[model samples]
Target chain A: MNFIYDPVPWVINWLTQLLLGWGLPINLVNTLLYLVGAVLICLGAMLFTTMLIWAERKIGGRFQDRLGPNRVGPWGIFQSIADMLKIFTKEYINPVGIDKIPFNLAPILAVAAVLAIWAVIPFSETVFGANINVALLFIIAIGGLGEMAIILAGFGSNNKYALLGAFRAVAQLISYEVPMVIVLLIPVMFSGSMGLNEIVQAQKIPFIIYAPVACVIFFICSIAENGRAPFDLIEADSELVAGYNIEYSGLKFGMFFVADFLHAFTSAIVFTTIFLGGWQGPGVEQMPVLGGAYMLIKTLVVYFLMLAIRFTLPRFRIDQMMALNWKILTPLALVTLLVTALVDKSIPHEMTLVRIGALVIVNVLLWLLADRMITAYRKRNPIQVVTGKARPLARPEILPVVEKEAAQ
Target chain B: MTGMQILFLITSAVVLFSSIMSVTAKRMIHSALWFVLALLGVAVVFAMLEASFFAVVQVLVYVGAIAILIIFATMLTRRALEDKGDQFNRATLVTLVIVSIIFAGLVVSLKSWAPLQNLTSPLSAEQLNVGVLGLALTAPDGFTLPFEVTSILLLAALIGAIYVAYERKEKKK
Candidate 1:
């Protein structure tokens, strides 16, 4: 087991023994060591986010054929640091008539929720934060905090536009989450364990190879949750004027932006952990530090995929987003979950190749069916026309034009 | 008090206080926010009890779904937009009386249970984990009856919601 070879737990064990050897109290030593570990994880995530901001902008810039930010430092690698300095010095804005408590609380709450999700993510075999038995549920629960932040920010701002934007974004969020959670059940059923480490260990075969449909559904829904282009209606800058966080300014706005960027990468990391074989690579078990490197590389690849999707797609109309969730993704995810569960049940646990093959066939069929159904549904009832209706040009409406001209 | 007991007391206090404030807050939205806080405190209390599954479930179902529902409903009602308004009627005494009666009954029932006399040791993590919870939920002769019934109830609720939202088309002809 990689757990046996992983050095993090061994290091912690060694530290505790060192403390005990030095005559420090046992419970206190254990508690202090845990605190340090948790703090280090938080720092790690934050530090990663700092670089991620630069990397994403660079990727986005290249995609758009721009120079990106080459001014600050070499290739603008220090752009995030410079941006942080600037945002730190900018004046904060409160704008009178806002609800004080929720207004102030929203930004921090948004960042904190994303931070909390890291508690369960297994970086390597023995390098998890909480590793709780119900880590999957814990992630879902922690997600509520982000939703609450959006609602509070919109309502607390006392702006009509903000409130309307909040309504739209929250609706989008809650609707998409239904499929996201349902899709999550596929992997949980496959592993038969909810602890993230257990899920990783169970994936001797990466889950994406087994349940591609669920992975695709999860990816789409997570993109909505992360709120980037296409699903980025929350900050649809052109129409809604920055949506729910419109009233926020300066560091407060910066906090929300940081959280947004963090969440995108976090979702990517989670996708790596769940769908790809996390930290599972050649020489990882022999040299456990390689596991961390493997995990990082996989996460960056998935995150780059997210960035590509974000930069490529056009924004979705609100109604189309809702229809996609309700009419398509939700039903597809539910069917996938059911089929996967059945496959898991019928196969002996030892028959790995046979089980994967069964799941893949079921997923392919369901994918084809879902695609056909969507195309057929669209043929029957296309999207409602948004622009003003056009009268028949040859009119038959020429009579109305002549009558209006005569009256004038 | 021990550290665990102290943590328990703090979380309980948070739940109790936030719940009272949730009922008393003037704005409906603010009240909903307070209700969320109270739910989170209850989740913390569950964690303190070493019921991590229940703790997360409480947050997932209540804080995520139910509280969001309440807020959405409040947003739907135009009256909930106002910060200052008459939120309740003059029959405060009647509600107080009804509430006290229920509280007293609960106290009396709890006092009668012998197992409640002393706190038992916390269950091992494995015993209280998702495996046990899953078995307890779906195993035959266990909670399977209630489990299946709940699923049916949820389906009924979904159908009812769809029915309510169905719009009839009046033919232009």
Candidate 2:
């Protein structure tokens, strides 16, 4: 293979030879290489967050009819860097009565939990940190760590508002995870494996075509999981100042901020990997490096779509959010998974066209049926609109009486 | 000692220490967090054993769901937070005796087992593939019955929980 086309293996080979030449043991060299790979992935993800923040702000500004940070540098690209430096220098305010260990550990765990999901994602044919067989489950499992971090931050802060925000966040996260996991089963069922790389390779045609309902549910659930807009009650500004990180300041606070931005983009990357045929395009086989480009392009598209949704939609009420997940998304995802599994088994794998057609038709029909049911339910039990005549304006005579009573 | 053995010993130590702290911690939340650490240590042990499926599942179900629920429940009960009562109660001595007897019995019984006497080689990567585990769980000739029964039990428990939590609304008639 050409060095330019697949530099990762070439670099690995060169390193292996160099380490051997230096007379290091095989096991030690392997361990060192693994550590290097992990550190690189972590650094790459953190650095990428800066760009994500800049892009999100610019897009969000456009959506709100304003110019984003333009003075920092060309297109305000250096804005996040400036913010990073300022945050680095800011003082960490330790609130009184705070639990020292959990408080200090929370931000690190928050960022680490998000970064851990990157370990299994396959950016290209040859580029992945790990090819663990249970990658899909690994993703969900890591999410638990994120939840723990939030709980720790809130509890450690010893602030009532922060605790309340954390409760709301945990509730939303746990509830949404139900549908997300169920939808995830659809892709796994289609690919017959949970390894992300194998899933990517299995996608001769993107799984989304075969399971659009699952795709949509997964997308919505991921957005909710990230606490993005429309499902962002976790950090409701009017209700809780800044949610779980309300008492955190400086770099601790910055870590949480970075986690949030990085998580949004990471979810986008995951969505692309699972649904949009990650790194799979024309000419990818001939030049595997181009697969990385394809992956990035697909991820950006999904990221932009998420940003659009975030900017356009209003946040859901807490009750509405829970109801949507439990009453709607969960049941719908279950049905989709069941239908997809049964249909997939009965059809012969050789007839690709027939299988796809059957799946698409079933998915469309299922969506239509769900829509009709919801519409009928709404008609049967219409939202109560309590209307009454406007109250009469207060008279001057009444106002005087009220003033006299108050004085008394 | 080999690196793997050393790592295993360290993990076991952590697990033991965390489990002790989980029970002995003064604060309920601290106890719960310690419990989580213990669970995570067990997950690490599972990972080291090459049982990636079990390792991930342990973290997902135990650490992710069960531990969080326990912590959430403890938080909801305000009294639990301030509880500074003695960790040991009136029945501590009796419980300790029973636990020790059980531990001794387990050790004696397990020591005589043939499998424990013979050290088997670790499974190859192919043999450890998750697909094999999945097939064994779902195949008709395999563990289908027990698997289905476990799912049913979980479903029943879930429904019972919802029933207990459900609020009844009185009629306005």
Candidate 3:
């Protein structure tokens, strides 16, 4: 293999030889390499957040017709860096009457949960952390950790508002996860594997082509999962006072902030990997490193779409959000999964184009049917308009008597 | 000790410590969190044993869903936040004696188990594929009956839960 095209194996070989030359045991060397790889991925993700924050803010500003952080640096590129510096130097406040241990642990767990997801995502061929078989499940499981972090933050802070926010966040997360997991099954069913790398490899034609409904639902659910705007009831400032992280300040707050931004980008990466045929484009077969570029491009497209949605849409009401998840998205996702599975199973694998066409047609039909049902439901139960009669004005005749008495 | 054994020992320690903390923590939320840790330690043990499917499922189901439910329940129920009463109750002695007797019996039974005496070779990565597990669970001659039964049980519970939670409105005049 060309070293320029695929440097991971080459670098590993060089390191292995050097370590052996230094008389290190093989197992020890392997363990060291694993640690280095893990640390590198974590640091890389953390560092990537600087750029992500800058991009999100700049894009958000443009969407809102304003210039965001223009004075900090060129295009305000260094603004996140300045913000990071400030956060680093800020006081770490431990609120009085707080549960000390979980309070301290929550932010770290928040960041760690997001970082743990990076381990299973295959960036490119031969360039990833562990290629575990149950990567998709691992992602969901890590999401559970994120939920735990919010719970811990809320419970530990000893603030009612914080607890309320955490409760709402968890409720939103857990509710949305049902549809998310259901739609996730479509891709796994299509690819016949749960391993992300294997899924990517199996996508000769992207799974999105086969299952667009699932893709849309997955995107919506992922946004809800990340607790971004349109679904950002987690930190609805108008009500809950910054949600679960209200009591957190300084770097602890910063950690939660970083996790939020990273999670958005990570979800995009995941969407790319599963649906957009990650790292699969022309010339990728010859130059595996080119796959990384392909992956980045696809991820950016999805990430931009997410940002656009975030900046444009207003947040959902808590009841509306729950209704969407259970009444609409969950049922729709189940039908999609069922239809896709049956169709895919019945059709022969050799008839790829036919299968794709059939699945797409079915999906469009399903979407229309759901739309029609929603419209009918709305018509059947029109919003009630309560217009009570205006109360009669209470004119006081005693004011004239008081004026006459004053004159006398 | 080999690395694997050392890792196993560390995992066991974590599991034991967390389990103890889960039962002994004064605050209910802290106890729930400790229980989650103990579940995670069990997941790690599953991973160490090369049952990646089981490990991931354990984390997804036990730590993710069940533990979260427990915590939520603890939080929502009035006066469930903290235990102000004495740790040991009047029946502690009797409970301890019965627990020890059961533990001793378990130890003896486990020691006498033939499978424990002869260690089987670990499965290869191919043999341990999740597809294999799926097949085993679904195949007619395998665990199809038990799997179907479990799912049916879950569906029943779900329906029962919804029934319990549902409220009937009084008729309008």
Candidate 4:
């Protein structure tokens, strides 16, 4: 079976033995290995973020059916790096009438929250940065902090547009977080654990095969939670200019940009773990270190698939977005949770077929129920104006005349 | 000192400094910021205690949610940033004296206490990943009650937050 081993440790061990021949302690060698791992992960996350930015633009373009960022490097690979350099050297404008303290501190907090979530994630069984018991909860909790930073950035800017965008972003974030948490409960229920590593290990048959409804809910909520396309109403360029980051420029903007991409990447990896059978592939079990390689490849595949969806889907309106969560996703997640609980508790753990059948029944029921709710909602609240005793619809041009009449 | 002891001292110092500054800061926002630092220090202490989940939740809820909420409330309720507030009064002196007494009492008590005996050995990667934690949370006789209770608590918090933050829609229609 293929197993993952952190190469740094093996290298360090060899080096330590060689150094012990020259009289050095093993503890120092171990510490050095840890430091190296930390540095590598940090640099790796940064590089990954940079690459994702380029990948997103290119993928987004192809979905829009056009070429994107082709000039910076071969296939626009270096585009994000070039953009980073430009941002770093750009003029740092501290606009007047802004709260200087919170204004400056917001970006740092934003990036810090994103990076913090990465610490507990098990990239591989052997390569977890810190395999905390509550890895899942920690990821969610730390991820939530980014909203506060955005809100602070908006309010501290003293710009009216920025404040409006900030509040909207906060509303969007806090509202969607509920369904996201509820959806995450599915894996936790099925696996009967909250730990991320536990969740991954529970996917022997893949939770997606059992809790497909929850998988769909989790994926959609994740997109909205991360503020990506379609659900990216928080940072809607056409509507809110640049949303919360409108007033920010230079490296401050860079930090927000990088943080946003990192959030997306992390979300992608997380979805892979919960729904897509993380790190498990055919024939990958037999090779050493290739297990981790397979896991990474799977994560990247999930990431690219997310990018594909981003490019392909049209952005939902804020009202439509919330309706999808509340009316559609939330109810579906509830059913999935109920079914998983029932299957785990009632059916024999050995009876895979029965469990699978029950799960399928639950998902099918949810889909039909969702369709019914939509149709019923449509019937109850028709788009066309009803005739009985309704106030006359105001004409756009005549509204000014009516206002003048009121004043008179 | 052992590594854990040094870490405990550092984190405690940070928590103490931040708590003091949180009350004493001149600006309201500064006080809120200091409170975030203090809460984060508490999270680190939780991590040191091997309660990783609690540590993450502490940061997620307190630093991420409550602190931001405080800053938002301060900004919304106040006008332009104002002058420094009084740092200390007679009540503060009394509180400080009581705090020091409690601290000294705790220190004296801890001097005679034995270190906690380790029960479980350090878990292997395979065991740590899904085995032990999974068995604990499930398995009928394990932590199912605690798990469900936490969910209930989370639900209560969510509903309470929504109710507290709710505003009535304007009656224009």
Candidate 5:
């Protein structure tokens, strides 16, 4: 791979080494190196997003019992490329009565926010964007910018539906964001460092096992935060007519489109690293090249898992979404946090057995409690009315009649 | 200029420019964006100090969270972005003048105050290790008070935000 004139990586490596040799300190050199990594990350994210769009469509098509994108290249591998070209060459129409400045700025801000957060994400042990100790917070905080961009896009479009959709998005984003940050703190607590790489390494057992409730909350929040399906009421296409980007067409629309797909990819990566013991495959790290490959495969698998969830689940009502977070995730996260702390305290540092036992006990108790709460709450106040006469007191009414005539 | 001095000059200018824009920008959203730029410049200054963690925190907390929240607040306030009247006036000018005077006084004091010349040297690996930051946050003697207080602050912020955003509505079908 480092053979005759690859040019880019070679030149970068050479230049970096030269800087180091010229009496430049290692940290200074690393800072300069990070600039290069940032650009590469942006490029990688774009490529991955494009691929994901194709993969998701094909997978979704298969799920729906249809063939997808069979025309473009072999098995439609190049379909996304064609779509990109179409989007690029399409006419850019600035709608009448729109706020010109914010309208244009919103998409740019959205894309930039996503890309900028990658600057702190550690790709591998050696390969990193930047080793900032506050990387975890940086990722979450930068992610908040995307919500602002969405709100701006909605308002800027000057469309009523867009405005409504944007408002919905803002509320949802801000709501889920509370629990999301709290769940993220679970990792930060265990890692005892805010750096993403250090956080990954801290998971001797993936935080998912040690803190399953936090894991579930984080996953749900990530989906909600990214405006994906089941939680994607903000862009409920059937209801809001493409949501915030209703008026946007051509490149403006493309920006939102690309942002959505890229967001999913990034979310998948985050979920994998935070909860799935990032890049930690058996015997993969021993061989440098294999490690990178394994990491990519794992990431792709996670991305597919997200896609599967997105396509499978029905969209939640906005109220249902809010209720789920406030009633379920927030309380669940709090309990998990307390349980983790207590278990961590009880585990003697010397005995692995005690630690494992504590972890298991905490997990089982959490599941039992959460399951009971969900089911009991559902039973006590069901989501809907049956519109039928009341049943006999002792009759098994789990399957209630939709409609019944009175005995005449 | 040496590299460090050059970095200092660029970042200082960036900070100055953005700070001015943040105050004077006509649009509230523009003002927020300018504030983000100012915070970014502050991060660069932290980088100059070789406090990489602090640099990232400046961006994460100030640029990311604070500025975004400010933008959110601006959006929530009805018609804040539509070029409005009297964002600045005579009273604002007076306030600016007083703030500038205080800033100058502070700068003068800082210039007169002795800096840690010995500690101005580059960081060692041990000092920069990720674990060191954790120790600083959790250690009883170091920043445990601030850390606990920040957690409390976050909780308060959450409650305050929920309060501000809460609406008392007429019960209706």
Candidate 6:
């Protein structure tokens, strides 16, 4: 609509005009523009990633009641820049006995995986990389590349600890992916299209308001996917001693580090686009910069919440992580998807308010019930908070069947 | 040749090369990785055919799930990680001949079918009806029987996997 206001498309148009003016063929010009667009998107994502790392650290420090990165440039805005410089100077160590090819390939592929997802991300009304119809599926496929990177990093290192980390990555990532995919289906169903732009446009009321359970499931699963704290068992610093990237050092290690931070931030943006009314704030269409601004704010809000969760919650035992995914989140997501789809189908599309209210009520009730049940269970079977050990029963009552078996 | 035709040839070459490498890689894990490459190449071919849905699904299911599972299985097996054993057995030559015969027969069969050999019919992507596809999958009087049966089959497989993995505890009297 407001084509003149949209910077990205405007730039593309201007660039194409300039190239055509220079006597370049139309087909060649189109291809050149495509390459230029891809390069711009990749560079933009990488540049944004530096800020995300700085913001994450700054926000983290504030949350933890400490000043972070104050020594660098003003408020440490240049902290990531400094870190980037340091990483470049660091030696790229190839550990003895490590597979050279996969070892080298892993980190680059990891960063590439994150960069590739930008292809389908709808930044504003007129700005996107590919505008793929099956953006969600495209995301899931790209996720495989990330997991493959972890596997390669772990295996190529030839370290048992790294191998264990890789195993955890596969287990946790794949398990969490199931619930994430299921919850993702709600947005697709609501939008009636798999395209991210369509999903964003479909949000008359944000999907989060309509189905908070899916959003929560998506957030939790996404946290696991990113291997952030609580679900950070894959690279549990306390346990695995840097996990899969233990053997990696210097710039290669930095790539993995950057990829991890970028992935979490990218997912936050994805969350914003899908569940929040991303760039849906007033004057966004008329002013494309405003759309980008709205997008950033929404992403930062989610990113802040994610950091709040990461710093607060303790890491999950691998068993607990699996149990949470398979036993609780997967079933919950499936039921939510089914119920919402059924309830949604019966309602007329124009009655969005009613549909949203119905779904919200259902979700809120479930949340309350789950909370109460958890609290009840906690009270009935109290555990020592300090030791994290279960309290013994006051009465030593045994099952008769067990007693009979013991006697036999 | 057209750019698309050149792209298609490159994709096919990758697929063929990777499939051969998948069977030939000494380490089982390496073989699995090669298999992943083959699957990805096939997915690219699907994309070339303008079937974005299947291309995405192929990568999601085959590369993401199956290839990983294969690698995971190999890791679980003894010495499969750095396996140095010969990938082929004593009957390699006989088996190779048999496989080659089958491949030639398939090529002959495909060439005989003019309708199947024609490549221009699906040049452009059809305006896909995802709703109809979804309905056909789950709706009665469609593919519901096979869909329901597949669910049951998956449930059976799940139970079988769990049963295999389960360690025996105390016996019931």
Task: Provide the TM-score for each candidate, comma-separated.
Answer: 0.93, 0.95, 0.94, 0.81, 0.83, 0.91
- Measured by DockQ, the strongest candidate is 3
**Model 6 error, position B149 (Å):** 2.8
For all candidates in order, the CA lDDT equals 0.88, 0.92, 0.91, 0.78, 0.79, 0.86
Tens-digit lDDT string for candidate 3 (A208-246): 898998999999999999999999899988998789999
Q: Mind giving the per-residue lDDT tens digits that candidate 3 earns over B59-134?
A: 9999779998999899887776555655778999999999999999999999999999997899897898989888
Order of models, best TM-score first: 2, 3, 1, 6, 5, 4
Clash pairs, model 6 backbone: none
The weakest ten consecutive residues by lDDT in model 4 chain A span: A1-10
The order by descending lDDT is 2, 3, 1, 6, 5, 4
For candidate 2, the docking band is medium
How far off is model 2, as Cα RMSD? Answer: 4.2
lDDT (tens digit, per residue) of candidate 6 on B35-71: 8889999999988877788899998999788888888
Expressed as tens digits, the lDDT of each residue in A265-302 for candidate 1 is 99988999999989888886677777788899999899
Interface DockQ per candidate? 0.74, 0.79, 0.80, 0.50, 0.44, 0.57
The true-versus-predicted C-alpha distance at residue B169 of model 3, in Å, is: 3.2
The weakest ten consecutive residues by lDDT in model 3 chain A span A391-400
Candidate with maximal lDDT: 2
Q: Cα lDDT of model 4 overall?
A: 0.78
Docking class of 3: high
Candidates 3 and 5 compared: the better one by TM-score is 3
When only the first chain is scored, the TM-scores of the models are: 0.91, 0.94, 0.93, 0.86, 0.87, 0.90
Candidate 1, superposed: residue stretches over 4 Å from native = A1-7, A383-408, B171-173
Q: DockQ order of candidates, best first?
A: 3, 2, 1, 6, 4, 5
Evaluated on the second chain alone, the candidates' TM-scores are 0.91, 0.92, 0.91, 0.61, 0.80, 0.86
lDDT of 3 at B119: 71
lDDT of 5 at B39: 87
What is candidate 1's CA lDDT for residue A171?
86
